[model samples]
Target: MIHAYRFYIDGEWVEPCVPKTLEVIDPSTEQPAGTIALGSAADVERAVTAARRAFAFFSRTSKAERIDLLKRIVAILKRRNDELGDIISREMGAPLAMARAEQAGIGATHFEQTIKALETFAFDYMQGSTRILREPIGTIGMITPWNWPINQIACKVAPALATGCTMVLKPSEIAPFNAVIFAEIMDEAGVPKGVFNLVQGDGLTVGVELAGHPDVDMVSFTGSTRAGIAVAQAAAPTVKRVHQELGGKSPNIILRSADFSAAVTAGVRRCFGNSGQTCTAPTRMLVPVERMEQASSIAASEAAVLVVGPPSDPRTDLGPVASSAQFDKIQTLIERGIAEGAELIAGGLGRPPHLDAGYYVRPTVFARVTNQMTIAREEIFGPVLSIIGYQSEDEAIAIANDTPYGLAAYIQGDPEEARALAGRLRAGSVRLNSAAWDSAAPFGGYKQSGNGREYGKFGLHEFTEVKGIVGFLND
Candidate 1:
């Protein structure tokens, strides 16, 4: 077995200050896949200090320097993409193809986007002779979740690096191998000493310390709503900028005028895309009251065909949940859905018949679910979908926005109707039909889903503080 017990601090890999170890289990096999050191508050101090020192010089670098650094990092990332994909598959339980296509791909995509943004970004602007300037926000503390490991890391790290803000990242202990690989990539690219750091540990200790540290000017976190609240509370006293992308119960509205089979089937497939672990997954499908039965049948039929198995298996379209804790939680939520009287349309609690071990979960679907149903309301973070029926367009929009979350929403209909409905949705992002992602667009949530934006120009701005140089400029 492999052992990753060292933390990256001050441009070097060293043992944790507090000597604690945790076994990393493979979700697909339920076996001890590896081991990593668990850092403590003291370790957080060391990392934060390193980043603080590095920020003094790194933050002053020109845009050209940052662009060169990002270019080198991108090249190194491409060289190690396959290895990163393998590590992600073993630690996070995504199918190998998915890991390669989506997981490792995050690194390259963010690097490219950051480089492009830096090339065209205007750091200084004149508005009525105010001479506003955007400067680095100082050392940032980043805490990322496991489900979309690279996605969150790149979204945060890329911007931080692009804007010359030094940072210390605490990736999820459950699937941290990918983070380690990413650190290696940064090092290989010759990143300045102490500019970037990594510490492996649980949320209660390291995460709290990082968020609450006085030296940390900003905290960018991506995780559950509970953990997000804790981060905010910890950072409140310091008044640090806290940017979070938390949980979601996003909606997928299927209009009566649309193609029912195609839409419902595509929705179910999208829900199960990442083993239903995506925060923005369309977990709640809003269908017309008159066509509830028909939509339910389509979702059920589609879910049954999902292939869940080992992550390394090429034939497996989806893999197991990230860990045993997630598996238990998913099982409990499935039970609650049934108890709440939601109609079970497809799979149910427990693993797929072929898989005896691992943290695998049955792809489940509930039909005729009301907005108040437990499955429809809570963020299950599993491979489960709930079909809720609505009578009117107003009711559909109401049901979609009823949850505390406003991360993303989907609308299906003819081009004109879908576009109109998309405009009316309250979520941060609205998908019309099979709309492709525009990396240049800003990404974040509304309401309790969390604050702040990441991606494109907005992402670069997240790591900066605006300053006004009013009297210094000549008329």
Candidate 2:
């Protein structure tokens, strides 16, 4: 009944050039929630032109003006936080609590962070006889995924706006209601006409068009490595700047000295947050060989306590996977885990017991999982855990870095030991002793987990290009 079957471009809601549409299904009910107009190459072109026109003057706006704009955006977003959470839960199947606490909350936080960073950030720095100026990169093309809909979109948009860069957004067609609401916030916040635009469609159509558009100066993408590669390739011929946050097969190392019960149980629970669909989930857990049994038992017991049910249910901790395709993909991976001879310590394929309808999946844990196993190497993007055993601390680190991903790594041990292990890991961010997040820290990956960083001043810098003004004083 919610109608979002159009694109928001040039500060107005416009129909797509092509009338292709896709039905969005609520994963909790397995019913059509709404339909979004699918955008095409022409639609992307229209958006790019709009953003390009807006960038000429908007990018030249003074820092103070941009700061005020960001603040206004933050205020508008906060006012509609509850409505945003509701749409996210219905469209993406996140529990209402998580939608409120993390999904919508992180979006507002990112905006606030951008505003704060802009206040102290130096756009022009004196360098001896010359000055180095950090200028806005021209129109950006942002392609965000479904798992953390607003989190990714806001992270990109807030920084782009703070840096005085205009942009066109292509949120995942699977869970796009949050984005629709976000477009409304931008409009309400008095963003200049054409400074922000939205085009909804699958990756093949709108995604490819946006990445390949010559007018688009940069493409900031968050999705699977496979898709990231495609976006990079598409933009390669144009030689545009490509920033990616790709797939992650993160490792959670539970040292023998750490409290096994507490660490294992807590780790499993956190990994399953967001239905275990997070890109940086601790899907690969490495434990000492002797402690494998204990870790597995604790993880399985903890997973049992997770309530997988409707997103609207206040008691449900884990909601349904975002879509039917995701549901099928998860089941196939779980079956692959069983076929590869890994012990299904707790759950297997299909929905959790007592949940007959919905695209729900059982919270599964697999033990004795080798690094070479299908589930261990692949990004499952489901509420599934794989426990791999190692003999020594060095061996554990090796197994942890064995994957193609290096997004995030977890270490549990004495503070000193954890810090030491964290340094050795090939990941961008390491959570030592289960530390809380630092908003100002740089976040990115080393290898295939994708390039470039987000959060704090690092994210603001990503949206800008630096130029040296040599000998202008002589003029």
1-475, model 2: which lDDT tens digit per residue? 6778889999999988877888899899899998888898999999999999999999989989988888998898888998989999999999998898889888889988888888999999888779999999999999999999998999899989999999999999888888999999999999999999999989998899999999999999999999999999999999999999998999999998898888898789878999999988899988999888888889999988889999999999999999898999999999999999999988788897798889999999999999999999999999999999999999999999898999999998888889878889999999876678776778888799999999979999999999998886665
Best by lDDT: 2
lDDT of 2: 0.92
Write model 1 residue lDDT over 1-475, tens digit each, in one string. 7688999999999888878899999999989989999999989999999999999999989999999999998898888888988888889899998898788888789779888888888888898758889999999999999998988898899889999999999999999889999999889899999999999999999999999999999999999999999999999999999999999999999998788899998899888888999998999999999998899888888888888888887889789999889999999999999999999988898998888999898889999899998898899999999999999988999999899999999998888888877878888898888577777778889988899999878899999999998865675
User: What lDDT score belongs to each candidate, Candidate 1 first?
Assistant: 0.91, 0.92
RMSD of 1: 1.0
Q: lDDT score, residue 140, model 1?
A: 95
Write down the RMSD of all candidates, one decimal each.
1.0, 1.1
Q: For residue 168, give model 2's deviation from the true position in Å.
A: 0.4
Which 10-residue window in model 1 sums to the lowest lDDT?
433-442
Clashing pairs in 1: none
